[model samples]
Target: MTLFRQIYALLFVLFLLIVASIAYVQFTETQSFLSKQMESDINNASHSLGLMLVPALEAGDDVATETLVNVLFEGGYYQQITLTWLVDGKQQVWTNDIRVTGVPQWFIDLNLFKPITKENVITSGWLQLAKLEITAHPGFGYHEMWRIISNIIIVFSILFLIAILFARVGLGMILKPLNSLSEHAQKIAKRQFGPDMPTPKTTELKELVRAFNSMSAQLKQVFSSLDEEVSALRKKNLVDHVSNLPNRQYMVSRINGWLSEPSSGALMLIKMDWLEDVHSQYGYQIRDETIKLLAEQLHQQLDEISPSVIARIAAYEFAVLIEESERDLLTRYLQCLIRTTNKEISKAGCKPNERFNIGIAERLGQMTVTDILAQADNALQRSRQDNKVFHWFENSQQQLFSREDWRVKLTEAINDKQFQFRWQPVMQLENTEVSQRELFCQLSIQDNMLHAGQFMPFVEMLSLGAMLDRCLIETVAKHNLFERNLEPIAINLTFQSISDQDFHVWLKQFLQNHSTPERVCFEIPEASVYSDLLSCEKICHIIRECGAKFGIDHFGRQFGSMTYLQNLRPSYVKLDQSFAFIEENQHNSELCRALVNVAKGLDIEVIVTGIQEQEQLARFSELRLDAYQGFIAPPEEIKLG
Candidate 1:
């Protein structure tokens, strides 16, 4: 038991001892005193009665003797009274039956009275009264003693109950520190520490709590630091540096994490694309400040029970993972975040008009982690088309998902030569049908056809996206002799696709080993550009120094400022689908005009993408677009032996 309980028990033992002592002492003294008083009263009554009767009996007045007997009996304090006269010096006794009167026979036996003491003096006629003896009524002391004892017991019982009541009330306060310590220990077991937990007050327990809290602090410090570095690695392709929220890359990473889960929870991926100017102007510092404030605001708005991870996956893109949280409440939470962040955006030099694209998904039963991530990623990608967050349906999970399946098929394809090299037919109008076309990626899984859209995006998110990408590139390079190709072949590089410090050095070494450096084209997604210009530029410079070509795919999607465009010096700028569709409104289309003009000024050729319709194809041709790719021209899968 606890110390308090032990103390309480000790006090209870002490109470019992005190009560027993008091009861014993009171009973003993009261019994002695009552016995003495009763004895004295009995003696007085016998003496008085004897004195009163002697005079009347000596006078030979029969009527007076009868009257004295009556008075002795009637005015008696004793239970029974009687008078007897000695004849011829013979002793005699007279008394009414005490048992027959109010006294019990058993009580009489229990308090059995011996012959009473007497002191006799001469009356007017001495009748030898000195020879008198008396006996008390049967139950005289029994009833009186029981009443005294019972009263003493009743009083002590009351005192005992009151003391127990007081003990319970006072015990809690005395044991407060112990209770606090118990709660603290429970929290420590769960690895949770914060201000919400109670702190103990007593010296010993307080010291324990302080020690425990310090340990927790150290653990958090270590783990949080580790998590931050992993976060930095995560940010290599996808993070808002200031808020540390996952950017597009982080969104893809979250999808990766979800896809990896045996049972994926709720996925709510939010894209904040309004902070481009903020990053471009203030150099990501203010953009980061804005995202940080927004993250705090968003976290405050989220469900207290809903666990979430926010990362800046791209410079202007933030992805939020709301795991197993309620949908409607999550919507409200997202709305709250949008309102709060946008409200503060202006003060942080980010606009109030910053838009958020949200994607919501839940894993279907019996699906691989990869498929779920694909579903979430596709949902996010599609949601980017709309301003509101979009919930996923069955179609959101594309056909032929999962890396293991893909890897297996890819290996078989690599062996069986099922892999086909398709040219995206990047035709410069100035040079039609040139022996060169930008090499587009195609995965022919026997009968099921998969494109980069099918699995590459999801693979880019996995820890080994870079590995898979490199493996694909190496396989293609190993099999294909790019040394003698007429058109330069473009190989895609993800922001994280090759962030391995060792891998970059390896790639530079590989460039020297295989294909001629001039024949290689390194294509990076413009939309997924790194936030750290210095790091990105340094990498780009390294790739350029390899004497290879560099181009940007999905260039206009980010709608970044022209300043970054000047820095990249890409060989090709792939126009976004929307830009390709809206080519007619040149004067009104500030976005497309800005992109095309900036690319022209930087000597970067523009490639309009997704031009499947004749109208779009016709329009882009009229606008002097550098190249075109889409269904308008039949796409023939290229076969490389």
Candidate 2:
């Protein structure tokens, strides 16, 4: 029951008790008053009768006395009347018996009223004649008591009902505000800090509503500020510092991801053979200028084949991954890139030798990454030996997949529902108990499982990222992951999906009908979140309103403030895999430490991934990270419920 109903019920019971007590007291008082009045009347009547009968009795007229007594008795004013006379030293009496009527026996017994009996000595001319006694009938008193009780019951019953109706209206007015307050509180719990609270007449309730509105406003402002900081950080993390293209780490991940798919591709390595010579001739400033000019030219030349990954892998080497199936088209692009570099170098007044030497290797079917790199290096050495600007390793693979083939394959995979989800456990670092299972979405085409990193680039390019995300969400719900494992499950969302307005709307409705909303966590990429903070914030709010939690995935890679951490106040933040290279990557360790301190101050759980070795686990042991995931424990197959 609600608090309002409980209080109203108690008040109603007390009101009934009070009414009953008052009615009983009034009935008792009325009964006493009627009984006393009847007694007084009887005493006065007996005295008067004695005086009247004395004349007859003193003259020894027994018939006159008897007639007087019978007249009084038959008048129905007395139940019995008696006259006693002294005759020859003995008492003679005249008596009359009268039966009472018109009063209920039960009522008379209940009231217990009795008529008063009075005795008077009759005298004639100062001589005692006879004794006269009169007893008043209790019928009048009984009738009066019944009338009083019936009136009291009727009047009070009407009054009690009126009081109840008034109380109900009054209480409804008072407690109606409480119901609004309850709904507001529920919305707040759902992270929907919306409009101001309703105004109520009651002073205390009005103040409470005002305070809640104030709190919501303050929260919204704080998150707004946090979003700004995160957005700035995300742009900084994705771009290469010197070249303004994607950095080497991102390029490597992209290439490795592409190599995972069953398609023919190529990796081209461009070395600035004469960069050292240029530096020796011109100062470091001129060297930097040359590198920048070279980078701009490469971007311009490769703009047509836009979707390829290009990066400044090192101070002197630039890497590009081409997932094109046709060797002739790939070769043509490489030649064009070389010519653009040559022209840019000439424009910058550099020697022909300082222009560029490029080496390319075709992606052999199922070849290890190490073998491909070695082949590329061999090709680069051959190009430099022959004094040629570009060289390509022989394309030995017979089966080649063009860009169109991959696109069609991806579309078919999605249409046919050729997808699988694997569950990776995140265990508490301190207790070593599984706390949650993070979901990894994969595409399976022709029985070949492809990791998200392998196909997401294509999926995003084709605007299918949101579709993939929804598929994963449905899969989780269909499998009843939470019900079967009794552990929380988290699914990742890409930048494209998060920014898509349509996806957010669909997700909101989906979560509302989901069975285990509270057990589901939506993992938003930290970089993606900053791209459109306002939209992401609204989406996050909707997710929370549906009883789901949000977390920042791939944290600590960006060089920006962690102020957003305090503002968004997500359930947890998962540190990116780079943070695990404690010995080799000092900068990464420092960044991890800074993030950890900030997270600790904000009371957010810090989950570290890529824990493949015990040393890496021990490195983070003292940091008191909340959870650990990755190669430390291979992903287990999920059994559907």
Candidate 3:
């Protein structure tokens, strides 16, 4: 019950008790006063009649005496009047009026009230000649008594109402601060509030708000540190050891997670056109330096507009995922990644005179992470083979995915099971060794292995993205674990999945019936959580109760204030390829140093996924990473590149 209701109930009960007591008192007093007043009036009347009748009786005037008795009987407020004669010690009574009516016996017998009667005698001036008796109407007394009781009840009832109204309004005023405190607590829990307190009316409540804000500020700092630590761990987890670029595992993992939500921008996959040529002529160092420069330039350019992930998914392969626009951030950012590649090479002590050929591919969404990369790669491959600038996916790229077509496919896929899970190792980089593997999901048919890239557009067009996520989790849990050694596998779900109004209730039941989260990764992307931050917190709190680890798959892409990161402590961060690649080729450089220092202060374990060689291991070793995974530590896996 609410505070007001509890207080109102208590007060209302007390009011009932007081009103009942007052009614009883009023009834008793009314009965007593009425009885006394009636007796007095009757005694006065009898004395007057006695004095007058004495003369008439002494004169032996029976007519006058009888007439006096009759006149008394006719008087109102008297129920009965009687005259009695005493002969030699025996009394005879004559009554002209009787006052008795159908009054309830229960009412008459009740102690709170009683009927009244009076007696009077007509006697000579010296001695009594005759006695007179009168009684109050039983019904009249009860009616009057009831009227007094009713009036008291009505007056008390009005008072009770006024008290209730005053109590409600006054209590609300008194506890206003407490109510605000409750709201503040909720907002703080959702990571929406800062260290400010709500002003309160009461001193104690004000003090409580002040204290809460103080503790909230302290907790904010503590969580911020933990958040940074976790994010650092996430970034550390996604690097290439040799090249210091994110590996294929991190790229696919990060990209799909980003695209799972609706994006306002585009996703592009850029491949080095003459990567093979550089390897052959310039040797490994320059070639590696060239790749690292591309990553840094892209990251420097693309980060402000949309988050970009640079990953070396394959040998000579690199991909970028941007969440902004094809025109605003992507088009311009893409030019920097490819166009400025040679200019930055000078800092790496490379020849500016060295001619470089590049193949780049990019696609505008709402495309999945891989398909965009594939098109970009396809464009790059075509550009390299045909010797042109970056080639976009041709054959009417925008028209290729009509809403009607994908909607049908999504509808059919949902009605029938089609998605499956692919396992990639999340290497706990201790002593430069791989420790564990986490599974990601992909939709599979007879031919194409559709990552979120190919099929999500269909799901989105059909407006069934949330349903697709459910299907994916269910499919992955059913198929992947039974067939492989998948542990702590996290399948990234779209924001829509978490924010569904009935999400928790439905998800709880789904897990109960379909799959438990022991080997399941209910991976929620950081961006997704950030978008619907409040709802995301609620969902995370609920989901975490199931003992599943809450992890943001791709981090370092969103340009968010660190405050939120401090509050939401995800399992780990998957670093952006830009930094990973910078660390890769630059080796012991300032940028990499800053990245490490910043990440450490946050207490996050660094995991590097893009390392392409043993020589690059020195860079991460100095970073004090908790774990690292990349080409150097790449384990044998068929599902991963």
Candidate 4:
């Protein structure tokens, strides 16, 4: 229970005890006092009656004496009244017994009142004519006692209730500061700090809160320094010194990472045809300047889209990799990029013959890292031979639809609401509980169904990835998935979609409209975040503020630098499934341990994904992952119940 409730309960119990004791004392004392007072009053009445009846006894008037005794007995205070006279030295008695009624038998027995009897001499002058004995009933005392006790109980009850209400109000006010401090502490655990915490009136609590705030500020400053150092180190290693774009190594690593996910897009290789001539005529200095200028312009154009990884690969060549929602738009964008580059070159006073040849290739299916680079390079060779500005190479062996054809199919599927959702439980390995479930969405066209691998790349290339994300959000929201299950729902957002500003705004608003924003999580790939850490950081901050959680999907794929993690401290990170297969190996096990330790330090949960085998599950259990998802949990259909 909360401290406020505990204190309130203790106070209530104390109040009840005090009220009961007071009621008991009051009831006993008032009843006893009333009994004594009634005895005294009845004794006085009997003595007076004996004196008044002297005339009747002296005259030997039996009828007058009987009438006088009957009158006193009818007064109701006395249960019985008796008159006695001695005649010819023998005792004579007159008695009236009127049974007590209307009072409860239990009350009468509990109150135990003994009758009072008094004797008096009825005299004419100085001689005693007869002795009169009077008996007084105390039944009326029992009735008065019950009334007094009942009134005392009612009055005490009201006082007790008022005391309890005031006590609760007072306690609540006092504990308000403690509640604020507790929330502040929780936020600090999440690496979030408040503007200013309210100071408590209690001296000890006030001091504690002050200490906590001071410690929190120091920690944030320390983390800030760490983040700066990590970012500088990452930039130094990954970026080219001349062009200030990511180097060949970073680009290749990123392409490899993207290949692992179920998405596709295009890669453009731009070669400066005039660079060799410029270097021979104007020397290396001017050639370098021209290349730098060209690099700057290309960076400006490609940076507009998300997941845009630009790099300087060779002396006369630059690579720009982009994942778009529509490949058709990418072609238009590339054509525009080529035209703009030529204009900049002409403005730099280069001859009309000074031109650029570009190679574009589609990224799809299970292609190796070398295959993608080779195909783009081959396209560049073909472009140079054909004397064309650009050439396209289909990287995958499987024949595919043209960009326009796929676009129509995607639009029709969306219009027909042909998306199907499947749920697989993310099990909490420590216990057997399902802590979360991941949503897998597929496009259904007539009798054929296609997974994300087939269509996501098309959606991303066409810039329709944002639409796909929105469709998922709306479907999940409408179903109230969180309400149907005891766990949160995890949905994947492509790098292109998260990079889209419109999608970012819509997601924020959607979370705000829902009562349980925390019950929904957005899964972003590790490489996608690394591709654009600055933008990802800003996006994550906004979404987290709206109470939505972020998880790094496909973690450890880069395996080179985790510096981005310092900036984007997500709620959890899912270890890529490939690690699970090699978990029994000592090297992989140690690597997994290192990752878990790093995650634990940042207070981020670690979950292993794609647990398909019993041995994999057992091996991961030994590794102590926070959760696991995939076939080991066995796929189950979601039910509203």
Best candidate according to TM-score: 4
Q: Is candidate 2 or 3 superior in TM-score?
A: 2
On lDDT, the stronger of 1 and 4 is 4
Cand. 1 TM to true fold: 0.41
- What is the alpha-carbon lDDT for the whole of candidate 1? 0.59
Query: Quick one: ranking by TM-score, best first?
Result: 4, 2, 3, 1
lDDT of 2 by residue, 8-30 (tens): 78988998898789978887787
lDDT of 4 by residue, 1-641 (tens): 98988998898888788878987887778767877887777767777777877888778887887787777766647654544456666454545555456667888887467777676676778877776666666667777776777787788789878887888788888888888888888878877655667677798788888888888888767655554544454456556777777777667756765665576677889888677777887888987887778778776775664447678887778887776335666777786677667866786566643467888888766676688889999998898888888899854465367778888988877666568777888888777688888888877665677777778877866767778788777877777876776688889887777788888888878888888888888888887776777768877887799998888998865535665665688989998765654426554555666666566657888998767777778876666579887787765654322
- List TM-score per model, in order: 0.41, 0.61, 0.54, 0.70
Give candidate 1 misplaced runs (Cα > 4 Å).
1-419, 444-447, 481-484, 586-588, 621-624
lDDT of 3 by residue, 357-400 (tens): 33444444456555666666666667656655455556354533
What is the RMSD of candidate 4? 7.4
Please list the C-alpha lDDT of all candidates, in the order they appear. 0.59, 0.72, 0.59, 0.74
Cα lDDT, model 4, residue 564? 64
lDDT, candidate 4, equals 0.74
